[model samples]
Target chain A: TQLLEQSPQFLSIQEGENLTVYCNSSSVFSSLQWYRQEPGEGPVLLVTVVTGGEVKKLKRLTFQFGDARKDSSLHITAAQPGDTGLYLCAGTQTGANNLFFGTGTRLTVIP
Target chain B: DAGITQSPRHKVTETGTPVTLRCHQTENHRYMYWYRQDPGHGLRLIHYSYGVKDTDKGEVSDGYSVSRSKTEDFLLTLESATSSQTSVYFCAISELDNTEAFFGQGTRLTVV
Candidate 1:
């Protein structure tokens, strides 16, 4: 059973378009993280959100943590071909050492 | 770039055969994890180690076992390979429980 669920299992968009990916769960978490992975490589950490209702921006990418700490979202503005890859969300429950991951979203940005 | 290496990047084995995957880290991180990635399941934890000789089962540990005899090495073993176990396996290391984790390139395993 997957603790977290992500929306839009796959996405494809043209260059300069926008897209958003969502990760949701019933259980609250102490922290949430987003990762991006390309083909044949390991997933790399993109950002971490610790507080509820907090939003962080990284150039063209924006990440937001839900107020209840049970959900998160990643939005990319003006998607580029280079942004094509898999996006995964992970969370650690309060007082728990184990990390749980979502189903994942595979994004493809066409030029 | 976190000094993590997974041996036998790709392997193919027959059903019921035993296989072992090695994950070595030079960072000396205290936490190590093994995860398997499949089509719809995404990434599921197989096993994890918190310290030398300390290991625990994860959500999908039915067909997998792990050993951490040393501080820098974590090993994942399949007592009997099965087709359902075929997937890409990843190894990750972290300094703390909730902090950022560094992952290995991943090993592709096939059970025929």
Candidate 2:
């Protein structure tokens, strides 16, 4: 079984603050995806990192995949109240098409 | 949006009763999955279907059963509802690989 572990289960910070979330796993993955879910709604796709050591940015959000393909990170710069949501990382194993999701990180940005 | 819809958005049933949830997709995707989400636990797969009449068990598939007779519909049934089965259920659809999966709004079930 593949297990993904996310750090900082809950985070609260004032607006304009910078925060980072980490997702680590013991097994290597072919691809990693990040999702943000609001209260009472399903998760929505944010980004996908396929290559090891790859970095992708979406406006104020930056995502990075580890060189070993076993870890990933999401960094938000100058966070705003709209950035508050539950962040989840899912990893697809080398040969499987299913994804194993991390525990998730609930972030709250206060204005 | 992925054009995915789940029926019975919220339901309350007693133990030992049979309940079925429906998932309908218009995306024409070949893969469909059923997942359960609980507090502190992100999401656990209950069952998945690769194609019509082709279904497989997922990580957590003990008390759940699924059927897919058409490409646009999938049904998940609970033989006998239990208190522990009370959770938010989500249906997802994907094409070919695991690139980007589209999820439904989810159905919240309560077993008393």
Candidate 3:
């Protein structure tokens, strides 16, 4: 079973549209991260959220960690074509040696 | 860009052959990981190393083995290549546990 699940599995929207992607799990994580992967390349870290109920903003992108630390969300406002890519959420559990990644959400922003 | 390099960016091998992918990093990170990406499965860890000469298996470690004899290099080996093992493999490194990880470009392996 996937330790983390993300939805929607695939998304398509026009330029200037707004969308939200979610990552949910039954297990609580000590830290959570979001990554973006372009074609033919590996994933790159976008942001890291460690505290529960913490919200961070990166320009047009907003990330929030759930109050219980079991979920998180990524929201993009006025999305552009540059936002098209596979978005992945990863989490690290307390005392765990490895990080777990979620089933990715592939987003396509059309111009 | 994170001082990580993966060799043999693309390879095609026959079934039953052995294949090894290499990950080298200059960051001197304490943690190194190997993961495979497939359709519907996202990225699943195969193995990881915490320190030189110390390694551990991840959830999908059945057909793969890893070694970390040196702090800067991690290797993933396939005992016997199978069509099912064809996928893009990635290498990641982090300075510490539960921290931000930087990933290598990837190695695309195809078993025919």
> Chain B alone, TM-score of each model?
0.98, 0.98, 0.98
Candidate 3 pairs with clashing backbones: none
Per-model clash counts, in order, read 0, 0, 0
Model 1 stretches with alpha carbons more than 4 Å out: none
> Model 1, B19-45: lDDT tens per residue?
999999999999999999999898888
Cand. 1 TM to true fold? 0.98
What tens digits encode model 1's per-residue C-alpha lDDT throughout A10-76? 9989999999999999999999999999999989999999999999999999999999999999999
| lDDT at B102, model 3 | 96
lDDT tens digits by residue: candidate 2, B1-112: 8899999999999999999999999999999999999877888889999999999998899999999999999999999999999999999999975668888999999999
Report the C-alpha displacement of residue A106, candidate 2, in angstroms. 0.4
Candidate 2 or 3, higher lDDT?
A: 3
Cα miss at A48, model 1 (Å)?
Answer: 0.5
A95 Cα displacement, candidate 1 (Å): 3.3
Chain A only: list TM-scores of all candidates. 0.98, 0.97, 0.99
**Across residues A6-107, which tens digit of lDDT does each residue of candidate 2 receive?**
999999999999999999999899999999999878889999999999999999999999999999999999999999999999999867757789989999
DockQ of each: 0.82, 0.69, 0.85
- What value does the lDDT take at residue A83 in candidate 3? 100
Candidate 3: regions farther than 4 A off: none
CAPRI accuracy category, model 2: medium
